[model samples]
Target: MTGPARSHTEAVAAVGRALAAYETQAGVAADAALVAARRIATDAAAAQADRQRHLERAEADLRACRAEPEARCTAEQARVVQEQHGLEVARRAVSMAERAVRDLAASRVRFRSEAAALITPGRTMTSVKGAELEAYLSSVGLRAVASAGPGSSSAGPVSAQRPSGGGGRDIGGLPEGFELVALDLVDVPDPVTGRDQFGKGYSPEDMAWAFSAFDDVVLPALRAGEGSEYFASLDAAEGRMGTRSYSDTYSGFLGSDAIVLEARPGGRYELSENGRHRFWVAQQTGRPTVPALVRR
Candidate 1:
């Protein structure tokens, strides 16, 4: 309660206020430093996370690249399979076409042969299975002309005639007594010399080449003829010429009988000795039967 006492109290209170202010300032400085440190730590953690994500993405890309080659290989294989299927389809088409040509050719031979057989001098008018043969010939692109025969007409113009039914189908059905002989690739003989000027002997290699030609060219040619708009009006159907097995050792018939030119499997060539000779004779006379030539 004295003046001196009051001044001392004021001084003490002032000293306390100064100490509190110092403590507050120290606390604000410490909080600011902690906030700065926290911000730095957050930024560092975000950077680390981003780097990890980038690394993961890079690894994923590397894996994808590694798998790409195999994927491409698989795609190539699929393309090859598709191409093989297309080739098989084309091969089957060719085979069917050949069959049509063979059938038509055979019918012509038979009619001519029968005509010759009926006559002593091998010259006479021959008739075939009337409606059936006519239809077949028509389908195969040959129209019957009662007015003439082979020597009687060239590929020249004749009187107006009805179109024949020569359209043929794939020969999946094997006819009785006929066998699918070896597919023969007939060679175009050297115009001057009637020999196989391309290869040596009638070995397997030669046969292979011949058959390949038949499959690739001759067969296709026959098919084209069968399907041609002009040729389709003939009556024709393909049948087995012959089939020869590799087991048969005697290559005796090669270059001999036209029928025995090639053999297929299942004893397609040489139905009988007499039949073979007859077939040979038929071929020589120009009444050639493709199937008969096969000799099975």
Candidate 2:
């Protein structure tokens, strides 16, 4: 929202491309995780069924054996015991599979929340006009296409439906009340602060490459642009930044919070987010400005 239209629009375009790629990647990944979870669940169910059948047969055989308590324990009794144990193990496996599927389902629900941060015109901006609307409408065009289905002449105004495109990482266009402004993450000069994830060091970006498409769009565009050392520092070679326990960017389709920024009394657009980690990462990576969605 600062700089000339050239940078803002260009920045918007870059973020747009990045978000589009991310949405694609997120969708594909969510689908894959679901498939994996379902497959495991199905396998677990089958195994449980098999074990149940074996246990039932074993129980039948044991019942058929009229064993005197003082005489001896028949082989059928031992078989029954083993089959019961097997059935228990199978039941545990089934339980674990079901749990994984549930977690994956929950992760998928947040995906839309993440995407809405950037594309959503918000409740306030719905009534505004001109470039802001134009830019919003433009971004909406990207998301609305795949969704609008064929024969739709045009994507309707964003107010027609809630926008959901960019992930929570970028603040392209947020809602109104507080002025929703686009700040180029790459252009933000000062080191922004949040809970530091870099003290022990950081994980390499490539690890995230496999999990998300941040690399596919943002990295390439930045590399092609002014060619800042910001990206040159990606710890691809070492496979890490430093000691780390948590997942890095793009580790999964974890529905993250938007990079919300509240203006301090000074009126400086330097305040900060629900997406604190993301904002910190952007500033650390030499990109705290362009892509951020902020409320002024």
Candidate 3:
């Protein structure tokens, strides 16, 4: 035990640090392999060209010897045959080098496909919230207890969840691109702590209104596809919301409250791991379709 009671985010961040380092090293390795393959190809072509020149010179010498005395012609012909053999060997070497380049290129593509699943944020199987986050931590050989104040215990397994209707994964769902759906279509998660923000004194309806207003403040930059700007706006909104007045009214909700929805292998809209209040607002307020990140 390194120690007890490490915060869940701290545990996840450790893995994230390792993942980032791996991504950097992988990028360097991929680039170097490609460069080496190209170099081999270039060198082989040069060698083949040199061999072709030698063969041509040998043929010329053989012709000259044929015009000389018959005795000398035999030796010249034998030397010309050796030059022809050297050219064949050089041609084979070039072919082999070309083959190596192709094999390495294919390997790189496969490596990227696999690493994308692990390293890319959206492509990762678990969002950093709710049951999925816990599941992910367990998969990587770490277990985290939700740091729920004094009597914290293991954040035991919550049911596996899916967006839309649910089936085994089908990557072919959104073959083209994202599908925009009315917020009414979104489904909020069943409460992990027995109830979501609705239980914290305010009525569910009022809490939803709060969430919707917060999202309205956060949505413009998000819709514009400005990642840094969106996150900055999100943080700003979180700060404003976390103040005593806002927090008291909004069930103590705070940072990173951007509504991340997913459309996984099925054309449906649902609240992502942390987006509970907003989904309720969507259902209650009849807000029109909003843009989503649409990760798998």
Candidate 4:
């Protein structure tokens, strides 16, 4: 009985040893599982942190994108304002240029109007007859302004034929380098009546008035030291036949280059060129008289 008890105790001890070895292996495996779980937890935490940073950056970029359109709109508005200002400046310049042109045109018109009024004399006439005035004017060694008809020759006969008085032919006495020109038809008086269109008669007073008007109004307006041409036609009254038979100072004969003798009615013989160049007179001798009058 003692041997049987001893063997049983040995078997029990062996079973105890096996159980302890199994327990040790199980503890090692539990420790390895705990380390693996900690590593997995740490990896998951790092991945979550990286995701949060990415989300923050994306939100900031979205805010900047939202503001971009407003910035562009503000720039566009500024450009439009600049363009409007430039257009306003151009319009103002054009208005100013137009005003300057109008002012210059107004100045020119005023200058011409004042000049014309200053040169012509103001006169009024009533019952002024053309032929009667012409006859009166002619008696004072004056001639009326003649009209040259269109088809009439310039060098042809320049006189009208009256019934008597040697056909009343008058000669033209134009100075050198000047030609006779006719006045406008409206300004001429009627031939039969001695009146103008205004029914005014021309008298010696009128002639004197015209001469004075020329001296006062016309001559002052002329350039300094300039000369003008004047013509006169004279008439002889009836019963003044002795003085009526007028003779030109050069009626006898004239040469292109010869000096002639002019005999005055007051018992004195003088030398002249038909009232032109009449300063020297000689004592009735046929000595070639021009050499003495050379103005030396």
RMSDs, each prediction?
44.8, 14.0, 17.6, 58.5
What is candidate 4's lDDT per residue for 1-296, written digit by digit as tens? 13433343333333333333343344445445555555545555555455555555555555565578644454445544554555455455445544544543343233322331232221001001222333444565554443222111121221111112211122233222211111110111122232232223333333333334322222222211212211011111111122121111111111242233332343233333331121111111111111111110
Superposed by TM-score, candidate 2 places the C-alpha of residue 57 at a distance from the truth, in angstroms, of 1.5
Choose 1 or 3, whichever is better by lDDT: 3
Which pairs clash in model 3?
none
Q: What number of backbone clashes does candidate 3 have, counting pairs of residues 3 or more apart or in separate chains?
A: 0
**Candidate 2 per-residue C-alpha lDDT over 211-237 given as tens digits, one digit per residue, 9 for 90 to 100:** 223323222222223122322223232
Overlapping backbone residue pairs in candidate 4 total 18
Q: Which candidate is the best by TM-score?
A: 3
Candidate 2 segments whose C-alpha is farther than 4 A from its true place: 1-15, 67-73, 118-296
Error of 2 at 103 (Å): 2.8
In order, the Cα lDDT scores of the candidates are 0.33, 0.44, 0.49, 0.30
User: How many pairs of residues collide in model 1?
Assistant: 45
The candidate scoring highest on lDDT is 3
Give the per-residue lDDT of model 3 (tens digit) for 137-188.
5667766555321101221111122323432122211122333345555655
Residue 141 in candidate 2, Cα distance off native in Å: 26
**2 versus 4: better TM-score goes to:** 2
> Could you arrange the candidates by lDDT from highest to lowest?
3, 2, 1, 4
Write the residue-wise lDDT of candidate 1 on 1-296 in tens digits: 23443343333334433433443354455446555555555555555555555555555555565678645454445544555555555555555555545554455444432322233111101111222333444576654443222211111111111212211112211122322232122221222132233334243343443333322222222322322221121212222112222111111222233233333353333233212332333233343123223332
| Candidate 2 weakest lDDT stretch, 10 residues | 144-153
